[model samples]
Target: MKRVYLLVITLFLLSLNMSAQKVYSVEYANQANVKVFVVDYENQADLKVFKVKYQNQAVKNEGRWFFTDYANQADKKIFFVKYANQADLKIYFVKYANQAGWINQSKLHLMY
Candidate 1:
């Protein structure tokens, strides 16, 4: 019974950590898990992103991102690409947190 309880608690904590949208911007494209492109228009984006001030506010994969100072502290490491064709994901910055979400569901796995 004690083992079962410990296992459940461990899984719950891991799920919470995995769901947080903590990101780090890498200087080199080779070091990034995903290459991102900033779109000129929101309609042209795969995801609409909102920058959150706190890491706790950036929960789940709803496009709310907390930029981490170090790559080791981040859930995902990304590199900004010069062109959309070179990107794994295309994003646009939204003014409000509520406006942040995936526009293209097909590209959702790229964030994970």
Candidate 2:
């Protein structure tokens, strides 16, 4: 019984964490939960975002972003900036999609 309880609790936490992983890019900044910029260099990014091919492949707020084909399917919607200076959040793409994560957690709230 105790083990079962622990498992349920663990799953709950995992779901919450996973919920933060899915992201959708909105067409306009007004529709986005956050405004993002893709930095030319990794060092200039606030978060290292991994673009997952599938939504199930996305992980928690660690920067795993799953771009939904439709905007309504996304957890947190975001808009990309043309320039780093115009962005509220700056991100860099990693080679492996799962390798995504936030270098700076300070701006995390903007997503939620």
Candidate 3:
């Protein structure tokens, strides 16, 4: 009985640590100018605005902050993959511009 209890505890601890592992690391943390709007793409894709955040303790001089349109809202994705993989900003912007028609026409492309 004691062995089974210990096994359960050990397994729980292992799962906890494993789940805490970080996802793909980013090299240029703030270099990417693309504003990751915190909106639920599943329900709506409204661009969220945000203000820049700064902490004197971290940046003694200055810092950048941003406000999202969907501030304090749900996360879009853990990390951007397809959006980042697109050719370049030009292509991405063009695609974004065209998506409005689909949305307006009530033809959202769901990958299901």
Candidate 4:
């Protein structure tokens, strides 16, 4: 019973960590975990992103992102590419938080 409680607590903590979408923008593509391209239209995007002011508000892989001041503080480091073909993920910035989400489920792993 004690082991089961510990396992539950551990899983809960890991879920919180995984949901925090803290990101850093890298200067070069080689320094990044994912290469991203900004789409002019929302329909052309793989993910619809919403920039959140607070780190706590950036929860979930649902496209809510918090930009960290330091690279070490981020969960994922990304570099913006000029062309769509050079990108691992294409994103569109959304005006509202509710509009943020993944359009292409196959490209979802790139954020993780």
Candidate 5:
């Protein structure tokens, strides 16, 4: 039916929007919505993050953080914490940077 086709198209578009994930770092922790810590080991991290070069290459709320030069230009602003315990989200940096996604998808909503 035409309605079914329209629904499918709408869902596809929504999925496309949700798939755009990009992150920016704020100067101050107080200025950031999410306070994060970079773990030295992958197992120590709550989430594994990959840095994306382009903003458009990022996902909606995945771990693909794009550090904006300016705080005002950021989407989901974040701050780096010295201690893992002090962080709201603990992440590990991966060598391969592609498809800015999350290793642990549970914390995905925290970015939003």
Candidate 6:
């Protein structure tokens, strides 16, 4: 019984440590061929408008606001997105899969 209890406790701790968490309002920007999947909580996120200014022009084709949670597409080094309303933004670069659709995968970085 004691060993079983220890195992249960260990599992609980591990789960807690590995829990996926979202920030109050955060964005991740990466420069690579990656598929990004987002789980939005718009009401809670307090999202703002964002954009990637390329050659001094906002990529309006990308869209107006990035959104609370949605998979973003990327094919080049710079990706423009609108969160809601912010002069500056914080981005977190993460991994992505190049499958048919975006799949939640581990954090990735371009090694080369």
What shift in Å separates residue 37 of candidate 4 from its native position after superposition?
A: 0.1
* Candidate 2 pairs with clashing backbones: 62-101
> For candidate 5, lDDT tens digit of each residue in 1-112?
9999999999998875673245667778888788999888887776777887887766556566677777666766778989888898888888776533566767767776
lDDT of 2 by residue, 25-55 (tens): 7778898888889888888888997777777
- Computed on alpha carbons, the lDDT of every model, listed in order, comes to 0.93, 0.79, 0.27, 0.92, 0.74, 0.30
Best of the candidates, TM-score: 1
Candidate 3 yields a Cα-based lDDT of: 0.27
Q: Model 4 clash pairs? A: none
lDDT of 1: 0.93
What's the lDDT for residue 51 in model 6?
Answer: 34
Rank list by TM-score:
1, 4, 2, 5, 6, 3
Tens-digit per-residue lDDT, 1-112, candidate 3: 9999999999998754431111122234343323232333423432211122322121111111222233232111123334433312111111222232122222111110
Ranking by lDDT: 1, 4, 2, 5, 6, 3
Which stretches in model 4 have alpha-carbon errors above 4 Å?
A: 1-17
**lDDT digits (tens) for residues 23-105 of candidate 6:** 11233455323223232532222122233223223222212222223233221232334542321222332222111111212
In terms of lDDT, the poorest run of 10 residues in model 4 is: 12-21
TM-score of each: 0.87, 0.77, 0.22, 0.86, 0.72, 0.23
Overall local distance difference test of candidate 6: 0.30
- TM-score quality measure for candidate 4: 0.86
Candidate 3 Cα outliers beyond 4 Å, as residue runs: 20-112
